[model samples]
Target: MLALTGYVDRLSAKPGGTIAFKISSTLGGEYLADLVRIRCGDPNPAGPGLKILPVDLPFGGRFRGRHQPVHLGSYGRIETPAALADVPVLTLSAVIWPTLPDGNAQAILTVGDPSGDAGIGLEIGPDGAALRLVTTGGTQTAAVGAPLTARAWYRIEATVDVAAGTARIVQTPLDPARLGLRAATTTVQVTGKPLLAGAGTMLAATPGGEGVPASRHYDGKLEAPTLVAGDLDTAGVPAGRVLAAWDLGRDIGGVRVVDIGPGGHHGVVVNLPTRGVTGARWTGREMCWRHAPKDYAAIHFHSDDLYDCGWETDFSFTVPDGMPSGLYGARLRSGEHEDIIPFYVRPTPGKTGAPVLFLASTFTYQAYANHRRGNLDEGFRARIKDWGANPNSPDDHSDYAHSTYNRHPDNSGVALSSRLRPMLTMRPGFLTFNDARGSGLRHFPADTHLLDWLEAKGIAYDILTDEDLDDEGVDLLRPYAAVLTGSHPEYHTPGTMDALETYTQEGGRLVYLGGNGFYWRIARNPDLPGVIEVRRAETGIRAWAAETGEYYHQLDGELGGLWRRNGRPPQRLAGVGFSSQGLFEGSHYRRLPAADDPAVAWIFEGVPETIIGDFGLSGGGAAGFELDRADVNLGTPPNTVVLASSEGHGPSFIPVFEDLLSHVNTLNGEPRDRLVRADMIYADLPSGGALFSVGSITFCGSLSHAGYDNPVSRILENVVRRFAAGS
Candidate 1:
């Protein structure tokens, strides 16, 4: 546990709404707590240093601290039914595809007492399948001598006859012809009496003794686990003797495991496993699980899946009746350690306080919460110490789990992300990279560049998050004259996309201040708050790719991947979509011929420099890293005008995969070099509404250059002022 760290239950709340804070501290004494308003967040000495300010509140005071633990892993738990408590004999069977066959002992199914010391379990070991029976006298085991192949389907069965004092275990490969595998079976004698089964049943994991968490988690897929009341043979048991049968394919969109047998012993899934996966009998016909649920009747369980910390609330705060809408945080301090848990306060419901609204990319932040890039070397550590930046990185900590951009221990892609744990990357002063030109910031801290500039310019604006906008429809944005985005609004839900598109088409000005906006499609469940799911399907600049038949999300049964593949490219809403990405470096943009048009020339009134944004805090230029461009074929409005385009990018940058049909050719027939550039565009809608897009993730980092008087800042100010006044 950290000396001081915590997280809020929600990202945003309106005035008169309450938010809870869950803290974890190892300090023996009391810790100081207070409220703060976050402004800059960046701590670079050359740029505007951290500008967090204190706010007086009644909830600020000293509080006692305690340590809280986070549990990680995924499994299924079913209460032991009356039929299973005192059976003469018991049989367990399941179809499994083990990803780590040679790994440590993994439990496929277990029927145990409350203490977990007295039970019968069917498990897979380094050699092969095994059955362990624990009684009052001693523990006994029976094993098959052969080894099981990894990533192969197999059927396992185990039987325990208490009165007969005998146990049996068997393993058979599903495809014996392909791997040259054979069936193996073993039967052993038992000497002690078995204990009553009143505790429960566990799948993919075993109970951790008394008053402990689950342990020995399985790393693979399991389907159609069933339990019988009598010692059954290979001939199969009668339907009336079936005690419980869990159909893993049922309720593919929820966490509950359905029981189709006569006994109603249903179970609930803990953490979150990969559902809608290919089962043992999957054919190559249907690609979607919704069309063929039987073929996708498997759940992939992992030992590192974490959905929540389940920590107790340390304190709670209710936004004052008239609190202003802005970014806020709970400052916690203990000894020499400190942490700030950030949250946003939105304007009161049914009230409009400002003409401009800043839409925070909370979904994107959660998607990259604890990303472990593995680039933190000695030089990065030295920079952190010298600059007094946040002293923690995901590379050094794995106890709280990682992001969807990372992979599991078995090398499978992480598909789900939860915001319940302390997100080290979202904290103030958190540096993502060690840059030679400027402070290396991304995501949360990087977005503050615009906030600091807005405060400095004395612009009155309200704040809202993607989650909030998703919960409330376009009505939440309909009252504002203009909506401005952050530096990297990449992850979004279909509802949020619909809201933005509707708002823009219905006479509302939209200023897209970032690149890679609305790139990937994400899913959310109302039953599971603060969690988001993504599937890196087919194509994109992704960290990992989803399996062939697992491209659909289990949260809402929606096909997951780039929005472009779903027929809703980012260009349709923002007039620009992702085009190129490269190392953390930048290049300058040149004014295009279309900028000279009298209708849009006013955007460059006071900016006389033809070559602007050459010097900035992020990679020393305004356009770098991920870039976007207007493509008419991909839904960019034909009436859109390109104001400027970036150039001079190093050879490290390349066009995205979606733009390439071959090594030497592009899908749109444009030169690869010309395709790897950002385009600044403007488009007018049918009403008085309009759009202004700057197609670079690093554009906001240039807003504070030359003390907030650079061309980038000037152009944005002109657009915001005009849009706010309804020009």
Candidate 2:
């Protein structure tokens, strides 16, 4: 346990007067043991109408244990008998605890007056003050004053003198404003049975006076809480220590500190050693005790491996025990990099619970290898995905994506060979592993419209950055009520699939708003890396190889087709293939009329539900030429519903996800948007009313466009809020 130290306000007051004290503490066994007690009780001497006053921690309640959960939150009291008239009586108490999840647990002290949960009692009346202690379930009273009413700091010490009483109450305090003062020479005598001072009113009152209800109470953040052994008068007061600045130097492990006084209290560490790290590698996620608002300063930076030390860093604060009241020298560094600079000193412990939002994909990101334009290839197609921001981009940064790349013609064009669609370019480095953030969307995920809306509603969020998903022992996505699958979630791993599949099956929600997803099987090898499956022979898009070589390998078996290989055909997510175009304009096939398309889901609430155009709907499959003909490629998962659809891609655009990693080999699945991208996916979760947008690909310009103030934006926003909030 990390015991709190430092000088408190000093006053020459009593029950009805001003008071203060400097306290010391240490660790015993494992719990925080009290070493020195100091305080200035009811300094404002009570003279009249002072009944019961109330005090509580700002946010809700607190825990009840020191170092361990065993016997936690036990409550109780302090005493003062015969409380002279309105000379108020005050007592002290609090709860201690370790961090959540144990393992690298550290002690944290939560201050509060435990309104009598422990075997402690008190009362205040007229005459003098008396203190009561309960042991073996019995009460023992200690008398200390005749009646005190004033304000001032008081130092109480109980020490060695056995013949004389142990408790020594003094009026001296230690304050930085008055640091270099000579230590007091002699201590006063305190005569009371086993414990020290205090005269409780009720204990000495003759009649029922204290019950009259008055208003004298205790207030303020007390610095030190402790317990001493004997008299300090003959031996003199203890000296205070001050030191700061800690340097852990290069890679280290389990570095801990402690105060060298009475109780041997271990100092609470802020920048902890990276967990699970050993022999040069780490197994667990890095953590820090930040005294600031939200931040993401470490990841990917040279300092991603560092930490800082400070309490609510913005505000100046005194150092706790074990260290001097200056900038303590404590830091974690690795060679030339300093991970934690200042470390952290906690705030006065309190935080509000806000709704949380998360943008993630189950199993996403991969390296693209094969290069072949579909029969509908515009230019160097797939090569131009994510707007060439892909790790696979050429050194010159030229983005040769295709026609539908986030709805940008230059991005979406696929270069053809002699019979070229555009100008096919070779990009061997193009990888999908860096698909987190908005990369997986075939585009970017930067959008102010979205961030503003979320912030206004008090939402905390996490983004799977544009790096390959590298989950450790925990499934980071599960904590969220919903997981969004961004546009074109073409890759899936067993872990990602397990987490998402489990999240939904556990009664979570899912939404599929993109097309032609989960349509291929893939593997990641150091060399010759590429997708392993293809569109179904029956419903997949037919690609025409240009002057370059065609796909070297042909996909066979179940996954090789669009039927999902296992369950029913994959188009089931949307219920119809590239055929249903009934909702609007030109079409290869019309919807089965209003009464026939049965997927009436909640997303359709407050809006008309329909499917239209199938061909040329912005390439992938909007309405054919924005006409109502294009189709929906990827279908819905279990418990999923469709709110809208289009047709015209071809006679066979079946809604199916192809790219995935399996237990051995299987099929399917899964969110961000904005920044920049060649592709994007937006969908609403079935639970918690969450909406997912994956990929940036030209979205900022779209949301920023004057037209965004229209229906499309409103509908999309509505869909996300409704589902994510479970409204």
Candidate 3:
């Protein structure tokens, strides 16, 4: 439990722009707030240690603090129709594939007053499917005695007859031939009639009263939930007019749920449930949802889906007109506890302040925002205490929410990640792994190594985030001579990719400073700002795999997966693509014969060593962790030069799954061992543009080695200087 934590409304803002900060403090008192410019976040004692310079701002002072609650769950809500308030009889039916059938009671459908307790609904619990009726007189229920099997599709129907004073609930398996399953039906006399005034409909959760949070979230897939004006027959078929039928199949790209019935009781999905999924009627005849949206009609909801924390703003800071573009944090402190909410400040919109741009991997950061790796053992804790690093870990706190890299409680892959909550993993000095060789930093904190080096070398650079680039496109990169990426820029949207590719093709220099970059394709919807969706379809080194026929993103209707699978391999843009991955350990890169080419020899001008970057903060070497290599067949330019290649990785390292054809062979016919090496490559593009790629996530970690005087540092400096000069 954290004593104090907070998050910003947005990740980046232009000068003179306002950004709000929301704080959650359990400390029951005023907490100190200040602004600080973050330089280096790596907290290793042997490294530069966390370097943050305080900035004097008018908003820096003590403020009252309070605990802000985070509500997590995904559901759909439809505004109540007047016709439902006085229906003589009603029946609710839907096709369901329950993921946690034996868990607590979960609402499948409910239509009732604002207070959900007074509702006519259908639910599934540990026992089985049930029909629940609540009214001004009393409450009644009819339940199926047998338990529903997990992950099996079943049609559930519940009917209520007000004048007849009777209700029934039935559960029929979609595949009756499956073993250990059978149809169930239960009937009971109703004692009271429904009183549904000012009613609304809820799917996957029981609605809470006004100012109350929802509960009893269902974890499963629901298809074609319909509400009928009358009763359902013994065969589970509706016998009356369809009052409202929610076709989850329509609008497969947005949050709106379509209602095909005459009542026009359409609803919107909250917290982003999984859409473009295989419904009960799916026949495997079509895989893409666009081809046959009906087969992908189901929406999979989870009890832990959190889109926004909806925290109130404790304070907001409008960047003063002349504020320089850089990384800044809202530093909050309550006695012994502290948190720094980081945000980037970019130059004024359509303005340029420097020749170089540092593109912060904010999308990747959000994708991995609160990743709970479940590896925070005693040793990891000990190192945090020893180094005085950020004390909070995702494993210790799940209130904010988990990352896209994590799975839900029901074991489904978390496909969407939002930046609207406190991101513990993006904070300064936040350690990720318990590395034996170097500081265990990966994303935001790890990216600061290059920042510290740039400051040490007195280089003028402006900073912007991936989100900014995605929104602004090529125009954002057009003002800069060179652009630099952060470490492990693994997640990107099509807009960002197109922008970078266009920038590079039109004479822009791109210094790809990390590995496994331009890899995963993500989707961003303008309507849902601060959130990105990823579907790990087909192939890649992924944390979780999207189910079959669920490869498209529900937000933008784009196919989500590896960029290579989308026909735009990273090699086409940066001269290298993801090739191998290993535990956090590193090995040195040896200078290749191509290093002697006069065309690019200046890259090694100040470095005479044949073996480069053998010692550094990240895993003790430059080429380690996730690695990429140039492959002509995969779109590497013919003119690309392989300057160096890393070797001597330990047995823990292996080729990425995409490169594998079998246990002994790879798709490119390279030996498995040979495919696991990182290549440092460079290529000259048309129109005076160029690309310099250091194909390792830990490459930037070596930039600060030996007081920023090492070969890796020198090589990068040469390229940056040349690129900035338009050479």
Using alpha carbons, what is the TM-score of model 1? 0.98
For each of the candidates, give the backbone clash count: 0, 194, 0
Q: Could you give candidate 1's per-residue lDDT for residues 563-611 as a string of tens digits?
A: 9999999999999999999998878889998988999988988988888
Write the residue-wise lDDT of candidate 3 on 233-316 in tens digits. Answer: 766567898888899999877889889988778899888888889998789888788888889889999999988889899999
lDDT of each: 0.87, 0.24, 0.89
lDDT of 2 by residue, 11-107 (tens): 1111222212222223222212121111100011111111111212121121122221111010111122222111111222111111111111111
Task: List the candidate 1 regions with Cα displacement exceeding 4 Å.
Answer: 82-85, 113-115, 231-240
Candidate 2's C-alpha runs over 4 A off are 1-365, 368-441, 445-460, 465-474, 524-539, 542-563, 566-642, 647-707
TM-score list, all predictions: 0.98, 0.30, 0.97
For model 3 the TM-score comes to 0.97
In model 2, the Cα lDDT at residue 464 comes to: 38
> Who wins the lDDT comparison?
3
Native-referenced Cα lDDT, model 3: 0.89
Ten-residue segment with the worst summed lDDT in candidate 2? 296-305
